[model samples]
Target: MVSFTASAQYGKQKKADTLFNKFSFVKAAEVYKELIENKYNEDYAVRRLADCYALLRDVKNAAKYYKKAVKQDNVPIEYYYNYAQALRGVEDYKGSREWMRRYKDSGGVTSTKNFGKDGNFITSIFNAKQQYFLSKVNFNSKLSDFGAYEHNGKVYFASTRDEGVSVKRLYGWNEQPFLDVYVTEKGSKDPVDHKAKLKGDVNSIYHDGPVAITKDGTTMYFTRNDFFKNVQEKDKKGINNIKIYRATLKDSVWTDVEDLPINNSEYTTQHPALSSDGKKLYFASDRPGGFGGSDIYAVDINEDGSLGTPENLGDVINTPGAEGMPFINNEGTLFFSSDGHVGLGMLDIFATVADKDNKIIDVINLGVPVNSSKDDFSFFMGEDGLTGYIASNRSGGMGDDDIYAYNRVPLLNVEGVVTDAINKKPIANAIITLLDGNNRQIAYMETDEEGYYEINIDRDVDYNITASQKKYEDDSESFTTKNIETKVTTITKNLELNPVQDVVILAELNTIYFDFDKHNIRPDAALELDKIVNLMLNEYPGMVIRIESHTDSRGDLTYNDKLSIDRANSTYEYLISKGIDPARITEHQGFGERRLTNGCDGSVNCEESNHQLNRRTEFIVIKMK
Candidate 1:
């Protein structure tokens, strides 16, 4: 909990202020720390110390001082937001939310307020599949090696790595050697010797490079400080604003270097990215009428190699905090770094999702491992989208900023066929349900006529695949994918469902009997007949049945035949009335006393139960599929 101050009344305070205003954050931080130690203007020095760490992407120290700065009276409202972001960098999300609440209460427009409406957002981000496996590239140095882009099988990047010389000039902001564009053999084994300066005049003595190249590899767009023709230009604050420049490749070397018309001495416009079709150029700028310290803008690349007016991407992509370092992939997805969005910390990379009309509709955070608490920017994806590179200033890197190669685990490609177990025949229109280990449904589809199904699923997850069809038993199989190694893997999983057991097996019904010498259905008999009607309507819609009625041996043959026929007709009418289609009842007949259950055909003594069975109607399943 340290504190400091700066006041115009002191000479040392004025010198620190001059350096701070010039963007010399590192040297300015040193002076601010000394002032705080000496107790000279403690209030202003404390807040400025936090600002220095924040700008340097040193989240831990930034959070430490910002905590103290926010407690002081008359603190600016934006300090609350900076403190909140610093808290997020340290993974203190609860503390971040509190400070963000205060910032919003004080009339600050922030993404935190928008994120608060969805309680599961943070959990969803963390719980999402970890699709990428990242490894540090070999050529990273102990300086700032970052901004990797690939073109024509060669990798190009911007780095402050020393070129085997002493007495090199350093940028005052970071006290590092000025950045220069460099090239290396793609996937080179000799990281030291294969790395060399780019084959072009684009690299300047001042900060240069981190470039974008068109698909044809004939043109390049790059960023550089406003220094040209052996002269450096400065704006009102004595700072050289950055600008974008275009260059052409010819005769195996880049030439025809020229500054783009979008450059303005009063503001910064840098970090160029060309669209896949080479018709649009996207870049970051802090020119007038921007929403924040910086915002992303786009300009049309005309047919004659000229440029059109710049268009701001609008408030959806820009916020009150800085947004910059845009990269557009071949699929037209815009990946950019932003500190304004609610994220894990200070500059997280977000990819835009656009509609079919090519208008950006949503932005998605590329959660952890790719993004860290420190600044992560400069994302480039290959055509397959699974292989890519990103730059991060987080710890365990070879430098202040290092490039990491990443491979996204491709979705598991699956196709299968479902069939009837007994006949080995395809089962059409069968429902296939896919569930996770938690039994939550992930996806579902109906099998085609060929009983074939195809779907893609996430890797390294447990799943249950189920197949179900009418008149068949449900079949399910458990599948688990673990540690699969491939760019894209295809698997086949076949399922066989057994047809339901015979319909007669469900015929264990109560004895459906008629009264002695009666041709009508009794109230008790109707209840039993309803069971047959229900089974036909619900379980087996295609079942065809026949009704048979018999009489006890106590009746005469002629009388029994007439009574049995009437009883059979009564059962048929009842089934039809219950919505069982008449077409499904193939026949109705009277068996009289011919089909006796026992020796109760007027020739032997039998119990009353035996007689009741002989006086019953029967539902025979003629056909079932």
Candidate 2:
């Protein structure tokens, strides 16, 4: 019975590892979780489960499981590095730093390719400048909708929505219907109502679509499974690898389909993109002799319609991880999605910066809203360059992968001043944070000497801003830019922070009094004075105060003046004896028979309780650093 149980466990583990190697993380994670639930090799299952979550960019769950994996015996040192990165993604900087130190101590080789210089890199990236505004397209359904392309006067994309087929077909990877090419008019009043499957022989029973077209719309290149002529071809493992195919349009119907020369039966070559002049074709492939799992390659389109040999984009454009979904804009810039770059999520979209000789110079991440903590790919830009679309599987989407429209507009300058509520004085060195509608931090900075901050933000967004400083209550406010309409708009949002009251006032202490003309610290008076000493010594060590004593109207003016001075000295000495710094008491003085709280002057008869209020000592707060 025990031998049979071990065999069953081995079978499940083999299946999960196979899926993971094939880059099907969503399906692999399900099997790994089931193994963990059944207690089948729980330690190995825990490590793989953590890795799956990390690859999925689900940092919250990844961190949770990694915390458990690191506590297990004989764990790999690489898991230490991954756990630190996952913690950093979830904004746990302190924990991440500690685990990173442990990873280094355990002889793990460190590299900053994925995580930059230090632990502070996450904050630096999160506070990047806003360059685009993203909103979900209205036509997205509760299925896999992505790979949006625009040509002529319509938009085409790949989707798994129902198409009324007599028999429902589903893909084993995600349990969704096979992808099909769909189209809708660009400026339709109701795009969902006008949506329909493309009119052509392009789509197949298997996966199809996400096509690229030429300037004259005479040619189209699309991705499809390794199936043609009603027969599917598979690799040795029985997996149908995707391939890029070229189709020509004749009389408004797509026909004459032929596979590209770059495709191989043993590997996958998909995601076709065309240059503006139609003289070059770019695509992603997992062919041999590449830098990573898949690399971006380009081929020359000769005048006679023959293709040249494929050339890899080089190591600078690829990493040990996957890089796919190539898109070239009208200005000859290449945009691609990658998982091996220093980014905010698993798959982030990046743009290439090429030199004068057309050699790639740099790769810049297309920062937030466009690249989220999930798989974001298939970036397409219109000819105007100001409008584009991106697909993401991040939270708050209507489908597995939803399309989001993006617009590039001039940045809005948001300037603000932070001041004290009581004195209206500018508060320098105050921390300011700007957050999006979901309370995710967008930018952060410290106030300048003038208590001023200026941040450039995207238009048509709601922000929650806050200011904080030592010994002051935090101030927060919300602002929106939906009403703004201009090339350059400056929003002035001022904040007022209230100072925390002194410890004595907050403690609500009773009056500290002495015997008539004795000028000695009484037992009752010492108890109240101890409260001030404890607060200053332990809580507010930087507190600076001044001591003042006042006398009643019953004594002679000259003697009462002498008595009040002694009383102030006694209170100051008592606080110093209790371990409070003597320098904290800025000054000690007395005013005799003056500044009475009640109308108990020499001419008026007053009760003893009224006069008691006059003979009191006061602790006035001068500064709290």
Candidate 3:
């Protein structure tokens, strides 16, 4: 091996390679940039600089350097991948896929369909309906600012604002001041003027910020540079990695700053987001055995206040690229930023919907205004869940990275429990549906074991929440979210469905009146039969019913039998036409005036009312499944 230790240029080259290997892209780019500006290592420096920008999702800069970074032969396959992604970020689809194809041919995945020109990635996200209306916050400065959170009546964020004495000491990487923790009163008309940096204990001379507060607001776990207590330690490359620190609030003062157990100096561990119960702390780390350069991890916040071993989120959420900046909303959604996922070619925000048991139900990207073809990260939402802030280096920002506030029109959700009216006990497995003002079904879901169901509704619309179950009468309630003016964000509705009647015999049926021995069903008869039809179809969706028709003894037995059969067939056909499944009809037959009530079997004269009773048609539950 040649010894290049005597050369200054070789020493810098080795340092840049070390930084890049450790995933310190921001500083690695700076080191590579110096090598290129001085012409010390133009060929190697240009390619490595572009690689650093690509990994950090600075796509525009990555593309710029990538134009000059190509080598004729023996180039690493990842260079093709980075150039392809950077090209896509600038909307140059044709150029992107050319390099993407090269990546596929060079020991990458054989299928280039995902990043190809014909890919549906952009079209899918662009065609989606906008979920939120974003407004750039007023407090963004001409430096990097991001990761805003709310507690009590104040908003806390990480910013490179000039208030900190460390502001004068710019970082060697981005040329911005070291990140410091800052706070301001929430919902202020001009929060920038009120923004103040945290005290010495919290905001140190090095990078500090992006904190996670507990539910009670008494404790917080934050991220800061590993230079604490004047004991600055570095790796083989002499670069100090990040660490997670815990601080407690006492009498409105944050103190007792201490290092968390999960921190590792060999790698970066930062971006702490505490669970709603403060029992688990979710964070982003570059630790080994991860699916990506960085992956979101979670550790138990033990009952005694010590930390447990970190667990990776899993393969579903982490890819082989960088993923960081994790935040868990009050409802247990894990929101994080990732360049690994298929998005608009930059860092895009995504979320994992979780149930109370912490099982992930779905993963979704927060598309469009919340995501652009630029580096967007550090997403945070407020207590209301509608108002929030994000960080982006997208076009027309006030700084290298600017903070943007997004206020979504509260997605009006209505949820409740279904229970028994008599015993007031939960009704599980009940089918619940929601309808709009026009009576169109908007959504439907089944009640869980605890009889809980939730659904979102459109704003300024009236809704009818209905619950149904076998052997139960359907119950419904009407609610309107129109003109609420944010006074009511969610509606709680409980439904108590009543049980249907146990059974009905033939005598209970309405009169089967016909005009002068005619067998056709009259309008009055149709109305009467409808009640039975509803009972069979709705009350017992799986039950089959037998339809029986009777006739008066005034006609011959053969003719009467034929006429009675006609009446039964006509009634059965009507039920079928009304959406009652034909397979649900067990029998449709006529008795032909046999065994008539009141002994009116043609041997004696009977009153009209008594004859009407004999002419009646009825049903009996024959089968159930």
Candidate 4:
């Protein structure tokens, strides 16, 4: 009947602090708000309440509290960090950057992490063919929802939905209805809206979800409250921790549920991601000795359906920030979300490929469409790879966290190493050229120190990759990227550039064509000649190039000889003008109609390509002084 604040009951302030310490943030916010309204410990109350909102990922409310507390003294540097993250989510770039600057100035935090890498990674990701963008789920509710995994044609995930049952009520953590695992009905009009089955045994009146279903659909690995098995464990802060659990479906109902061996009540272990074969289990934990708040870990599944010891994914995949929601694709590539690595803001999704030895390899941030300034996590890719699902709290979402369908248009990871064919060692600094099926230049990059080069390619396209070095023979490979069933995404274009032999062909230019009955160099012909000029003047200065020009057998032999001579002289003069010494050209001879490459020597009806092949010029190393 009356308004009461902490000033009216200062004795309860310690109780509020205790509740906050227990990570019961929603309830703590209420107490802190009361204290602030009554002018009791207003500064700390406003700041602490704001921290709770930020931790809960309520960006707008966090921003509100930050605006009030930013001017206060003795505020933690993370407050500035949270302020920046929250500002960016609300489209306040200038404010966010300024707050980022303050966070840097006020004892800037650095933990062996590349803070700007994620933002830069986004650039290249978008520059490559765009493939992943969020599509709002049709059945997203106004409550928190996330972590959708597809199994048996239905998607199983976690959600906070209302069921109008009192005993199945609120969780003090977010003040939402107890989180439960839900699944979409494959035959339903809208699967996301379908009530999930196997709830009672597998789910508790506490948080449950983001499950990993085995290939057989008989076993499940999921996360739920630690109290599910009467093991009510809490951290030093008194907040109940989460544990990973495994269960089996008996008679179409999940009957047996048990916690994994690696789960600890003292910290937290949640977000289960399993390999497609169910042999590898990846999850997030906040246990000590981690790089930061939470780190991604992996455990091998034994042949007997038990877990191996947990292994940290190391510094590459796990940073000093939170990393969760690991999803391993069909090819064993690991996809997870991290806040430790520098990203657009908050948590961003990243991927790491697995080597043949089944060890995790290079981690890459999946920039732009999959990541935003707002928190984006809970990524699941279907077997087809063309479509998947991700969970995010970015702007324009249906709820606190909504599941969005991600459709990848056509993208693939193309990688290879340039090695000397003779030595079998990686070639460093080899120039690599990428061309599409139409022979149009796509992109170029040099090999790294280890002779490794990787690039993103649009799928369903035939690509030609040419690798060249000054002293090595140019090598090229034709790559056809088939979408959907593209397990060969990481194409090993392991090019072997053999050293030039005595009779060297420096530039293997494709059919250098001339215009009909013409001797002058066309644009395509000039481009090819330029490459020869470069080889002669810049690369092979000591070699003498004999430019031999030929024409189709369509004209008189004498006239053809004269026209071919003109063509040879035109190419020679162009090379000379481009700084290739006249001495380098030992001879510019015209072969006329005598050297027709094919039987289409005016004796048979042939297509233009055959005729063009005959109307060609080539440079050969005749003498190497």
- Of the candidates shown, which would achieve the greatest TM-score relative to the real structure? 1
Tell me the lDDT of model 3 at 298.
96
- As for candidate 2, its clashing pairs are none
In candidate 3, what are the lDDT values of residues 528-623, reduced to their tens digit? 777767765555454567888878888789988987888889888988888887877878998887847667776677787777777767776654
**What is the TM-score (0 to 1) of candidate 3?**
0.68
> What is the per-residue lDDT of model 4 for residues 132-229, given as tens digits with 9 covering 90 to 100?
76677775788888888887788787888754444557776777887788877643565443255445488776778879988988888989888756
> In model 2, which runs have C-alpha deviations exceeding 4 angstroms?
11-31, 50-63, 70-121, 189-195, 410-625
Top candidate, metric lDDT = 1
**Candidate 3, pairs of clashing residues:** none
Better of 1 and 2 by TM-score: 1
Q: Best to worst by TM-score, what's the order?
A: 1, 4, 3, 2
The TM-scores, one per candidate, come to 0.73, 0.61, 0.68, 0.68
The local distance difference test score of model 3 is 0.78
Candidate 1 global lDDT = 0.84
Candidate 4 segments exceeding 4 Å error:
1-12, 22-24, 91-108, 116-128, 164-168, 190-195, 228-238, 353-362, 410-625
What are the runs in model 3 whose C-alpha is more than 4 Å off? 1-42, 52-58, 68-71, 93-98, 109-118, 163-167, 189-195, 354-358, 410-625
**Which pairs clash in model 4?**
none
Residue-pair clashes per prediction, in order, are: 8, 0, 0, 0
TM-score of candidate 1 on Cα atoms, chains taken together: 0.73
Candidate 2 lDDT tens digits, 10-29: 89999999987765777888
Superposition error at 450 for model 3 (Å): 20
